[model samples]
Target: MRTAAELKYGEKGIINDIDGSHPSSRRILEVGFTPGQEIQLINMSAFRDPIAFSVRGTIIAIRKDEASCIKVL
Candidate 1:
């Protein structure tokens, strides 16, 4: 498994788990980062801080710090 942050642009993976202890985990869940969900790395900022992803049919942007806590297979 690898972290969401490790996924290159246009790559896809299934969400395996998330670090629940992370403060943003709840917000990430609410935004639909649940286990088994398929997510695609859509794009990234110039500095690669906030990355854009396609999840649950919607495109959302999340920071690298938060993405690092999301494990994907």
Candidate 2:
């Protein structure tokens, strides 16, 4: 039940499920945050609001609140 926002720097996890209740869920999925996809916590801001992740060979940065909707295992 760990969320992407909880991942430590350099930690990796497989995407389990996405909270469709979130307004940006569809956009997140469209960009590659799909179930079964592997994601890594590559970087985070000093405040940790916008975190960067490596998924599908690309690095993407997302907000902590938005990342909370991503369930990871």
Candidate 3:
């Protein structure tokens, strides 16, 4: 498994798991970052701290730190 943070821009993957104990995990889940969901790295900010993604029919942005806790296949 690889982390969502490792996905390059425009890359796509299926969510395998998320480290639920992480502080922001609940908010991530609430935004539809769940297992078996398809996610695509849509874009990144100029500094790349917040990365945009297309997931579960919506577009959301998350920081690299939070993205690291999400595992993908």
Encode model 1's per-residue lDDT on 1-73: one tens digit a residue: 7999999889999999999988999999999999999999998999988999899999989999999889999
TM-score winner between candidates 2 and 3: 2
Regions more than 4 Å wrong, model 1 = none
Q: Each prediction's Cα RMSD?
A: 0.7, 0.6, 0.7
The candidate maximizing lDDT is 2
For model 2, the stretches where C-alpha displacement exceeds 4 angstroms are none
Residue range 28-49, candidate 3, lDDT tens digits: 9999999999999998999987
- How far in Å is the alpha carbon of 37 misplaced in model 3? 0.3
Q: Global lDDT for candidate 1? A: 0.94
Query: What TM-score would every model get versus the actual structure?
Result: 0.96, 0.96, 0.95
27-68, model 2: which lDDT tens digit per residue? 999999999999999988899779999999999999998999
Query: How well does candidate 3 score on lDDT at residue 7?
Result: 97
Candidate 1 deviates by what RMSD? 0.7
Q: How many residue pairs clash in each candidate?
A: 0, 0, 0
